[model samples]
Target: MINYLHREQILPAPIEKVWAYFCDPKNLNEITPPDMKFEIVSGGDVKMYEGQVVEYRVEFVRGLRSLWLTEIAHVRENEYFVDEQRVGPYRFWYHEHSFESVPAGVKMTDHVTYAAPFGLIGDVVNAVWIRQRLNGIFDFRYQKIVELFGSVK
Candidate 1:
């Protein structure tokens, strides 16, 4: 079954600045939760593009490390982009990162649609673990964003 998560925040920064931050894969580690130990395996200044693929090593529950690969499926410059999982724990994962210029600043949003593996077992796992874990990760990401961009006014 497919599950969804949505989050929106306004950053007190210009759209161009926020766009650069999100597009550069190198900045991922700074926003990710420290506990996850998320690291981009691919080296150098990674730029986001329609066909670019990103690889990462992430530590999940119980200290189990997994390799995840995702492809940037779509891009609209500073407007929005979509990344889909090519290889990961999920049966399917599609995430959209959107940005809009607002009166206050830039409104950034994340829309995630993902399905767990193992059918019934996956449902149980998502209910018991995956869902909460996903939310926790986003919570950490949110806090980290606020720290880097300042409190949303």
Candidate 2:
């Protein structure tokens, strides 16, 4: 089964500046929670581009590290970009980050479609734990972005 997650935030910054920040893979660590221990193991120095493959080392649960490999599947300048999992814990993962210029500033949106490993058991785990964990991760990202860029006002 595929699960979806969506979140939107408006920042008090121009679309160009916001796009630059999000397009750089290195900046991901800054927005992610410290406890997750998210780090780019390779291919993060250069800015994102189509077919770019990035590797990461992450500890989603404390002390349990996992290697995640993803490819930048699509890009459209300051409009949107998508990253799909090539190798990771998830059975499938595709994330789209979109940006638009709003009257207040830039409206950023995150849309994720993913499925956990296993079958019925995975769905049960997702319902009991994974879903909440994903929500918390995005919540941290939203707060961190607001702290870094300031809220739309």
Instruction: Identify the candidate with maximal TM-score.
Output: 2
What is the lDDT of every predicted structure here? 0.91, 0.95
Worst 10 residues of 2 by lDDT: 144-153
Backbone clashes in each candidate structure, one number apiece? 0, 0
Residue-wise lDDT of candidate 1 within 9-77, one digit each (tens)? 999999999999999989888988888888888732568889898999998866898889999999999
Relative to the true structure, candidate 2 has a C-alpha RMSD (angstroms) of: 0.7
For residue 35, model 1's alpha carbon misses the true position, in angstroms, by 1.3
Q: Pick the candidate with the highest lDDT.
A: 2
